[model samples]
Target chain A: MSGAVPWNEARAQEIIDAHLGLEGPALPILHAIQEEFGYVPEAVVPQMAQSLNISRAEMHGVVTFYHDFRHAPAGRHVLKLCRAESCQSMGSEKIAKDFLERIKLEWGGTANDGSLTVEAVYCLGLCAHSPGALYDGEPIGRVDGEILDELASEAQKS
Target chain B: MTKIYVPRDMAALAVGAKRVLAAIEKEASARGETIQIIRNGSRGLLWLEPLVEVETPEGRIGYGNVKPSDVPSLFDAGFLKGGAHPLSIGKVEDHPYWAKQTRVTFERVGIIDPVNLDDYVAHGGGQGLAKAFEIGPAKVIEEVTKSGLRGRGGAGFPAGIKWKTVADAPADRRYVVTNADEGDSGTFADRMVMEGDPFVLIEGMTICGYAIGASKGFIYLRAEYPQCAEVLTEALEAARKAGWLGENVRGSGFAFDIELRIGAGAYVCGEETSLLESLEGHRGIVRAKPPLPAHVGFMGRPTVVNNVLTLATAPAILAKGGEFYASFGVGRSRGTMPLQIAGNVKYGGLYETPFGLTLGEIVNDIGGGTLTGRPVRAVQCGGPLGAYVPPSLFDTPFDYEAFQKHDSLIGHGGLVVFDDTVDMMQMARFGMEFCAIESCGKCTPCRIGSTRGVETIDKIVEGVDVEANIELLSDLCNTMKFGSLCALGGFAPYPVESALRHYPEDFRKATLPAAAE
Candidate 1:
């Protein structure tokens, strides 16, 4: 059930065979599956387990442990907000509070509207300047309460 | 043929990297000098920003902080073949400022072309990863433990112990997550390494994948580092194409892969557990420990969460041998740390040095004192969440144990200098305010305590219930530190207390005007 690639049996075997007999190879297998199918499907778990001679629970555990590894489908747009000390110094806390309230979602919580999913990020090294936010992985500088509202509204559109 | 590196960091650009690049292109064409113009990153010698290099009779000759207008004069001084220019700081090795630094982790960061794989190989870049891969998993874990590398991402947990947990987990499922969520203030070391020598990160990650038996890795990169993210993506692709990141790297048949997961602006996510939750497509809040990420992390599998800088240093450690890496630092804290010097400083830049230097030396000598050329009133080592170090503590040596003795922790090694003009009142409010904003509101201490602290500080500054408010603010800070779940709440008062202690006058009411705490 991975995006366009379609996680059929043959591709699953290729991913399994790819990481054979290597030094601790869970991450490598995960990377291939993620690449082949935008997300790791349940079906591929058994294949991976069979291929690695491990249990499906083991594969599931590995898949779930990484925040970056997605088992289910993800939306097109991913927005991240700064929660570091510098950004927080510039009133990012208030900005985030109001923005989340407006969107009615917590940090890292995806919108039911399906337009965007917002998450929290730590220092991005833009600290001398603060109250930063990112839209679709693009870091925008000079964020304030009003600016956050505007940005969230923009994300709502996409 | 003479060789030189043109640094491409922002500080270098501000001084004259762009103009120097153009000049080099023009002059190299006109003179037919086979000058290799590699746009490398900074060597962390900031005052020497826009620094140019010349492969000379002696090693690479560096011109400190070159200006575009001064370029012609440098070339005229017979600098083409590394002749001595007036601005030349001599051979890079001889410079006392650079020579003093223990640049093990940052050895090839600013020197090599970030995208050039061959360059990465020539400088012994992937040697550590190669060695690590050759040694197998158990040996890699043992090597990490032997080196005594702690989490550079604030926690300072043993990297070996973390790996061993994952290695020994009963479930066959496992993961290696690189925490690129570097949200501390005054920290640019992560960004610098990401931009300067991206391949090192890739190689480092590959080594992690190999050791943990992890087949896939994810760098939860912050969105603010768009340039870094872009370059990293390109590097991953290049690595994959060359079979370095993809299946069967180095013909070892050890399949490994890496990807970038962009972060939303959330500071709490810098915490490993929060990062895992965020990566799992949920809110970036901290999970209660006991389970720890090693046992019930990510998707409830054994997992290893490491900092970008920490992981990036792995390949180097493996390549050089554990003993060599362990020998650099002071005592229990081993290896070099990248200390970022920022704010009101003449030479505000990043300096990589071994543990155990004094705060005074770093702020005054290496940074060349304050940027305004005035007496430095306060120095904030280790980011905003870190303590406000006073001149009295100037003799305090840098290292984990040393800082712990002084009632502070080195959180990401960012050193921000402030002149006497800084107000403790505003600074205190900032500390509370920062936590208030970034707090995931997972607990009461951070969520409400921060807001309460701000009001208390504001009242004291305004002269209303001044004595009572100070007592209340101090009391609140203690509770937060004691009661808060994460550093976001616990360490929030470091800057506040340090600020209040050093700059009491700034927080005094106009009516009382008492300067001493």
Candidate 2:
């Protein structure tokens, strides 16, 4: 997770305005908003819809349809473990299960202390190095239980 | 100064190539050595990554799986001059893995500085666009048609036919969209092309624009590929600076530019219409075909929608002429397919070869069987939607028609091997579960049928009227197969049906313990 600042209407508007000239501005606007605040604030939905001249339902639908968009702020650090076939073949399920159990956190759950959030991803495109993960968007391959625990501790310390 | 090559490919970076590079830099400074470190792409020999190569007088010498701790010792062993070391695999091109590959699309992927336009030209990049100009748009399409190059995006539709459709469709403004939303597991050829050789794709898309009279293009890249996004962004800028993009490409009076759009993690967006919808910044729901994308696509204009591999191969087909590319493979499946070998295999990596090798050769010989050292039981050809092939069908040749004949597909050329310990019932259940998770939910058959399939499998797993549940599961699969709106629901039954047909014992075994209890 990035060091996302607190949401401000001025900042959100600036971000949205910068990308409004693009052919398909909705996704770019959403991505920029997420990048700035770490999550798309629900309050900005209507604001964006009005700005783009689209209906609120249409804007909300665009936001909710994609899996990448986050509804709430993530923890300081994020780890996405692969749940696809390639990773599954290399015992990624056991790795994920053990890590979640050790941390007492379910998939897509954030730590109470806001140290880290663990999420399930389909694939990280590191199939050749099976059982891959992305820790704050940095790819980690051949991931095992030990690696996950180490990453968790590292996140907490940082 | 000695030149050293380190892969900036996602797989290499994941396996600590950055750390190795840092260690190398630190060690070099300590030893007062002058060296040029070129961050190249992976050669696809992933089992040996981070595969460091030192350009020696003899050739580029390889050091396989080098850790930071080994960096000092590598220097001590005179690795710069291709000196003797335990990790040394000699000249990398001489390795059996590298020698056996028939790289056409990937010819320059691991060989060039990805973003460097001059390096791209040196490695035969711009020649395709030059040839396209020489032969004219009609002849360009003719060459592509004659090459027998089908869409490597699993559809296996002729690329020439689709290009021709977009070309013939009369419109004031046409669009060319490259589907880079590679959502398939056990596959990364598209990512490799984007990250390793972005210029090739740019050139390929440029040729398509010239042939189809489309000045504007968009690449719908998946958001999972953050690194590819960065690489392609830089590559696109480099292209524009060099007049390869922008108004009047390469001094030709044609205006073309490519915009990179990030997909919001939708697997169905890999489908053409869904991709266009996503590009238009909407919910990536599939559109009904007939007004086909070629006829009304990308803002209701004529469009050429092609996969990453299909577009990447265009430059080569145009440069060498169609017949040269057509001579490689057997039957209709001409040219090389970059078979992404992954999963529980010992030597897992990308192997680009002509379509004809048996599954047995790929899984056993090329892959060196299972990494677990267990007997191979099954191999999942294509993505999650693909069928599970038992060891009995290992002799089947890896081609579109041949695999289709066996009720399986050579979809996207992804081979995910499994050891004997794999539970077919579990895999079958996962098939439905994945579909249920990824289905666009526009059609009831996919949205509802997938959920029903999962429950039916679970019922059979729990041994609750096992025989009846099995029959019900098969019947549900048939409904989903024929009744669904798109391939999502249509092909979702493949894995479920294949597992039930071949590995009947595993399904029965799941019920046995529950029945005894």
Candidate 3:
């Protein structure tokens, strides 16, 4: 869950300033910004580049290159279903597809009411417990339709 | 005081270990019982998690799959004193799964409090670093070289030679970089080592720093493993406080400190050069070889990069001597591998044993076959890029060369099993699609060829010129294998090629319906 506070430029600067001392601080700075703002705000990309003495395109490239760095703020909660090999073998694809269809959503889609955002993750390393997911940073294993429905309902309620 | 153990591992928590912990505390309070609960790492018996262990006069008795609801029954049965119960599986050490593992790298993972410095020392943790200091830098490299230790990060490159290159190279400063970006499916050994026994990795990295004369180290952990990141951060701080890290490690007057760097979700960063690029806060694109990461890396300095498992095993090799480790596995692949058995398996978990075990032994005997009670159609021996191994090739030993001989790999020792109902055509298509999505786009063959591969497979499946498309697909695979800059494109064809070679029936079955129509 993120977007608790609106995007703050001053706070983003403070986050950028703190990490600028370290060698190769771009990724860490981006991570901190996302941690506070829920996503890497486009407005702050140029700011970060200016501070780090790199071009905006370079900063944007770095941010966009990694899948974890979101452009817009996610919903109040995020549900990342594993679509990797292990989970696929255990039927995660069907589980994910059914749940998305039931919710009238697609992969990386945020709900209309802004309750949940469903995304596809390659692997969470919970392979032994295949068909696993991370619901707001908590790993849920052996995920089925019922579990997904329950997770969705819980997210909506919260 | 009666002591009870509950796993704090992510897999344990995923299946409601947190709820179980709370329930146990509530139940203990209701019964007016005083209990000492220690949160330890998983025993690698994943199917039996939230495995609750009770320290008895005889040994640690185990209970499998203990839900929160099952807590009261466990308490009523007097499980504190290791009382008899239906869920009880006897002493955990005596369990068939526990008994089978050699556990060189994972010896202390499930046995001790992961973050506690003293618990680490009590369980024989720092002995390797002490041994590293005693033998000095060159001798440490010599020991690792003699151990025949290869990179556990899928490539199977000799780790000692990599270190020796970094050490001998001329540099103002050097670095010990650990590629902890464990993105491969069916692999969690890196996550386990970091979460279970962070000290072992820390110790191993320190040994590398000591050997290579690198004062600084960085562990580029993946963003997916938040728990590992948390545990590793805590472990690093603890190690620093204990004089085992930072300036003057263990009063040895050698300055070696480790900084934890979290990777953004990029699978290619698992590759050494791309990892170095990611560390530099840039786009994670592959670098050409010749001046490998060993010679010049991480801001143009000599770097010693190794996988978590490879580094974690270093301490044991130094302490016990290389020959002790060399004696464990088959030819070329020395020491034990913590093979992760996952996907559709009955007893899926981490199994650490010597090389040379047949694929049949692992799947049928150790794994107890498929979880669905169906025949295993195929098992992908490595990660997503690994070839689909048919049942006919089940006799293939779990060695690097043996797997390579079959156009398969022992990549990170992760085996994702598939049941008989699996569609090989779909699996092959998914392999190409995965490559298309994950390709770093540094090379043409991987970036463009993978998408073409998907289209070609789709055409063949739809009965549209099947023979011609198959030929096209094979040619496409050949080009990607040889033309790609790195393994992302280079090895993406393994599953596709293997599926076509072994399971042509599935592809034909799909085509037959369209052919009739």
Highest lDDT: give the candidate number.
Answer: 3
Q: Cα deviation of B488 in candidate 2 (Å)?
A: 1.3
Q: Roughly what TM-score does model 3 have, to 2 decimal places?
A: 0.99
Model 1's CAPRI class is incorrect
Return whichever of 1 and 3 wins on DockQ: 3
Chain A accuracy of model 1 expressed as TM-score: 0.71
Better of 2 and 3 by DockQ: 3
What would the per-residue lDDT of candidate 2 be over residues B274-349, giving only the tens digit for each residue? 8888888889899998899999999999999998999999999999989999998988889999999999999988
Clashes of each: 35, 0, 0
Q: What C-alpha lDDT do the candidate models reach, one value each?
A: 0.76, 0.92, 0.92
lDDT of 1 by residue, B386-414 (tens): 88887889998888999988778887888
Decreasing lDDT order of the candidates: 3, 2, 1
For candidate 2, the chain B TM-score comes to 0.99
When just chain B is superposed on the true chain B, each candidate scores a TM-score of: 0.94, 0.99, 0.99
Tens-place lDDT per residue, model 3, B1-517, is 8888998899988899999999999999999999999888899999999898999999999999999999999988989999989999999999999998899999998878899999999999999999999989999999999999999999999989999999999999999999899989999999988889999999999999999999999999999888888899999999999999988999999999999999988888998899999999999999998688888899989998899999999999998999999999998989899999999999999999999999999999999889999999999988989999999999999999999999999999999999998999999999999999888899999999999999998898787888899999999999999999899999999999999999988878756766688
- Which 10 consecutive residues of model 2 chain B have the lowest summed lDDT? B506-515
lDDT digits (tens) for residues A2-44 of candidate 2:
6799989999999989988888788989998999999999989
TM-scores of all candidate predictions against the true structure: 0.77, 0.99, 0.99
